[model samples]
Target: MADEKQPAVAPAPDAPREVTSKDGSSHEEITTPTRPPGWMYKGFKVFGHELWYASPLFQLLLVSLVCFMCPGMYNALSGLGGGGQVDHKAQDDASTALYSTFAVVAFFSGSIANKLGVRLTLSFGGLGYVIYIASFLSYNHNQNHGFVVFAGALLGVCAGLLWTAQGTIMMSYPTEDMKGRYISWFWIIFNLGAVIGSLIPLGQNINKVAGPVTDGTYVGFLVLTLIGAVLALCLCDVGKVQREDGSKVIMMKNPSWITEFKGLFETITSAPWVVLLFPMFFASNTFYTYQSNDMNGSQFNTRTRALNNTLYWLAQIFGAVIVGYALDFAGARRSVRAKGSFIALIILTFAIWGGGYAWQKDQVTREETAEEGFVTVDWSDGGKKYVGPMFLYMFYGFYDAAWQTCIYWYMGALSNSGRKAANLAGFYKGIQSAGAAVFWRLDGLKKPFDTMFGATWGLLGGALLIAAPVIWMKIQDTVPLEEDLKFSDETVADVAGAQGAADQAVTAQPEAVRTSKEGGGAKEVV
Candidate 1:
């Protein structure tokens, strides 16, 4: 401060500008390139910036709410109203028909979206959902099983569109580094919606209400459907992204849709492991069928039935959270190791839970009969004698949670790199529907088959559970891409350089030209 300070000298006009890379490398800065208009950065953001907070959350919540309400309405109609024995067979046929339709429609919708883009596809799907819901609400009130089945078929189509588009939107938001975390959060929220959905029926007094279609219960589904339609309209288009040159890039163009569809076919043909994941998914569906069948099949009173549903959802929540966290951590550390080990754990868990149920049924039968001191006990009517252990309920809950977490994470991870995340999700769900269809038929036959029926279904589930790990092991060798980083260092550098160049170019414009353009006149300059 005591010495006189020298003024800073400006750089020479020819002097090179310095630029820094993310890795700390330096380079001569050149005039940056100009970016095309309307290029926006599409990548991960913190908390409120997450894509999950966008329309996806709303869609998910709406879907969950509708799902929750539909079952309640069905249960109230079929079970609560002193209605004659609800045709369980007819219900299965309806569900099967719907699922079959959903599968086919999902495949086509995915292809169409790839062609027409997400917005149109989503809008169409949302509108379809609105129509389907209206139809269902109208017919369900009148106890029109035929119309209900028809409406269900329409709903399936809507589900195909909504689910495919929604899945694509969710996966498109997160970058690789944060994909696992984001997906985990997404599922957690999704399940939370399910929890809320489960509670809707409970609050609406679906079980207690004596009248035909209780107040607010039927209306709740309609409200949810409307909300879903609105949210679907708001979904972000994942197909649009900015290229390095700041040009608009469409991931899948018109001709590319066919190529992508063919690619999906090739993927299935070549990557057999992807196909293998299907059976495990199917096994999980079997459990769901088991639970539904048990609910409908059992003679449990209203309170017990409600308790069963509550427990089922509670277990699902617990399982989803725990397994989701585990999968995330495992993926972070070593994705392959995590996947293999997780699958194995799931398989073992399913085996134990399924085996335990099988054993518990046998044990309870022996205990009850032994207590009666009957040498030749005729336990012909197994309905009165059959008692599932309380512990089995808890075990079943845990198993379901673990199974679902694996399915979601596995499919998400597998399809993350592909343009067909929606299709994959749709296909997986479609297969689940197919499994439900098969098992529902089996459930109908349980009357004549007795305990053998339940045991056979459990065995099939176990077999599928066992197959998952084996298939995963084989598929593990085919390395799928991990999360794709949105803004790589090179990309960032390119952007920064381009921006700097644009600024410099403008700055370098002559004052005379600028003055001329501003109407100061060339004579003034002379």
Candidate 2:
């Protein structure tokens, strides 16, 4: 028989539960994991089994499927076309319109999350996506781009609400020890949309694609969006969430929304955002714009474009999982991690843009389509097999994973106050959106390739170089990066050594020792 496993020993009282931060303040650490996941949701007055939401696995699955339905199928499919592959400009315009609202929508996301909770707020966000996809099917299809823009704004608002709540839940739901792991699971599951959506373009071909898409696509996607929205509705209330130990967090709130609004400003002015998050905001916004306009539009053809999305999304899943381990690496200080990330991101950016700059002329070429109203694009390099540009998306996926993971992890580390963290998440998303909106208006809506490429390098380069240093200097963690096992081992050794020394002292004493008690009873002491 295999040796029986030993149960985990509790920490000794003398073991440090807090650390002195860089700012000279003492902060408590999550010395213990939270309550183990029970049933997803407790049912009735008495329950033995947990609900689906109680399981982190289920929650991950739920969010994954939701992302697939909304952004995965509908948005990705539209990127290169409406039908399958019809009009790039029109579709691109529609996308630009949608992206245009991200700043305003994401700005208010936290306040909305606070009022409505994560579940209902995600539902609100998911519903906009449903409407946007449905709009593509209506007569408004190719008639007016304005309607598409309006619909896109709705999606943006919803996205703002959803992302804020979702970030909060992800950050708050897991125990402190699980923070990195939780973020990894989030991206891992969420990107399923890209994996599945990639296959759709393979069968649909550029010629077969249309303005509103085929009837089956509309009805099928509509149903899919609903399913995702429903899943969002099923999310657990953020306030009344339960920990792994079966302990429930109390739900509390400020007296007014006005007070909450005022608090967001303070969060914006804080160290995490002011010092570390700006470059990330610039980088994320520019990347989204680059992907939307230059890379997705003028750079690659239908099939290759789909491949880019597929590879990027698929790779990000791997990247997210990998980066999660990196962030949680034992005994690795934040300073070391930030430096490594900065160097890696900088190299990747150069590889994507600088290395591929030579092939720019051959990489993207155009031809007149059979339809008078449409323009045909060929991202192929005269069948020369240029692989460099395509790989850029893959590198982007990897960089994206690290960037998102570090930012969120850093956010959790810096802000112990839940309100501040929640607001900061909203602020981060909003700034990201706002930046994208600026890019959409400038380079992406109908941007020339040169401008788009220039912005991509400058923005991403700035992010890696600038933000990386800010992270090293200003972003401090209250929790030590030392591995628990190492710390525990040292503690146990010290305790045992002290005990052994005490025993030796006792042994060295006289064989008989006596002490007199003042109260008449005699007690012997050694």
Candidate 3:
């Protein structure tokens, strides 16, 4: 008889162990103390054991679904050019209102998320999307742009909360090696909401040549967003989540409101390198108004716009996958992947935007000569002019995904702690929203199309130039565990099973600055 195989022993807390991958490869992973099974999943048996509802992947899936129903549906409507209205001005003004509030609230929403917990924050966030969608429905009948703008303002506040929590979880939940793929998965599911939601308008008004989206289209979106609001409540608390390797997710204990703000200030002061990415963040969402209203909305008829919106989101999925795989490729070091992605993005950015520039010039030329403004292109145009613009729009979608994926990956590269991730996410959204607000207001004011277009192109190039040195100097093969876990009074006991011991050694100590094992570390917990 063959010798009995011995049971594998678990690694001690904070011990490094070699973990085998499914591809018959292995790498070292540090194990954090594991928590007891969450009460929510207790006694819920599956295959003779408790189901892991508090699993990292499962919780990520839950968050993805929530975004899918909320922002996903919102994107579908936005893609229809001016929220599927004949006039672009109303939608542009509403967007300006939305981003204006978003900039302010998102800057501080990280503290709110940390205080209220992700579940409540996310649930509250979903409510704004519901109301925003309804505003569109009301506008469909009453044509009250004020109601729409009010809804946008309200949604911006809620969005700040929702997205800060989401960013925390997305950056924190995945293992270091899996961050890219996890982001890709979340993005795919989230955008599916847009793709499926776009179909509602397409199916409802497929035969209609050129007009606003039907009332039924808004109704469909409203229903899905409501479902997402409820789903937000179902997320498991952070401490309960366990990774595939049995380590719990990293989280710092909550401090006072004063302390949290101080922490934010500290982050800004100490990690000033992060400021380099501000231009990139600011430019991130600024292009949406132009893409949605100026390009897709102005150039295509209702049915064709719907079709282009579907293809646009579809391209987003593919773009995310391509970048995600490249970023997470196992053969290269993480730092190598980061540098490689940066280079590829630069190349792709200039190339795609170059195409956009040519297209914009053509549109400008046509508009100058046409007596009645630009004519909307329908599929009936026999693909002469339609196919070229269609491809351009899809590539726009692809570049959007690639750009966003890189930003998220860059943020993820900075740390693995949820608290820090929340702060970073807030800062990112804050700057991004500010830039978007400016651009949306410009579009709303009916600024010259070529002027806005040139600004967008110039900003993208300039931001990348500023961010280049920071990427090369700061990003690394890996983040040190101690550096990542800094800033909280919590210990391994806080996140692990030693719940009763968590508060035993609490003290009012000031923040400590330490040089990380990785050479130059940022400020951390005392």
Best of the candidates, TM-score:
3
Sort every candidate by lDDT, greatest first: 3, 2, 1
| Residue pairs in candidate 1 whose N, alpha carbon or C atoms collide under 3 angstroms | 31-501, 32-501, 33-498
Screening candidate 3 with a backbone cut-off below 3 angstroms (N, C-alpha, C), the clashing residue pairs are 487-525
Q: 100, model 3: CA deviation in Å?
A: 0.3
Encode model 2's per-residue lDDT on 1-526: one tens digit a residue: 2323222433432233555556664443323322233342224221132334454345545666677777666645554433233445444555556665667777777776766666787788889878876766662345555666677777777778777776776665555556677788777767767566655654454444223235555556677787888778776554444443433322224325775666666565534446456667645755655564455544445565656667777877888898776766657675566556556556766865665465554444233232345533344453445366566667667767776777787676554344555676787787777666667666534555666667766776776666655666654545331222121112222222223323433455534222223333333232
Better of 2 and 3 by TM-score: 3
Predict model 1's lDDT versus the native. Answer: 0.48
Q: Which parts of model 3 are misplaced by more than 4 Å?
A: 1-51, 364-374, 493-526
Q: RMSD, each candidate, Å? A: 11.9, 10.8, 8.9
lDDT of 3 by residue, 322-429 (tens): 998788899999988988988988898899989989888767532442236557788778564888888988999999999999999999998887888888999999
Query: Can you rank all candidates by TM-score, best first?
Result: 3, 2, 1
**lDDT scores of the candidates, listed in order:** 0.48, 0.58, 0.82
lDDT of 1 by residue, 1-526 (tens): 5322222332322234666656664445433223222312234334444222223333344343333333323333332212112234445555565666776777666566556666566666655444444544564456566765675677677667755665555454333333444444555554454455445555665345122234354466556556646654554454333223332212343336556577457546645657656666565555554554443224333333334455555666666666656655633443564455465555656565565556435432322322333232111323423234333554566666666656665655554432456557666666766665566556545433235346545655665555555444542322322122121112222222244334434455556423532255421111
Return whichever of 1 and 3 wins on TM-score. Answer: 3
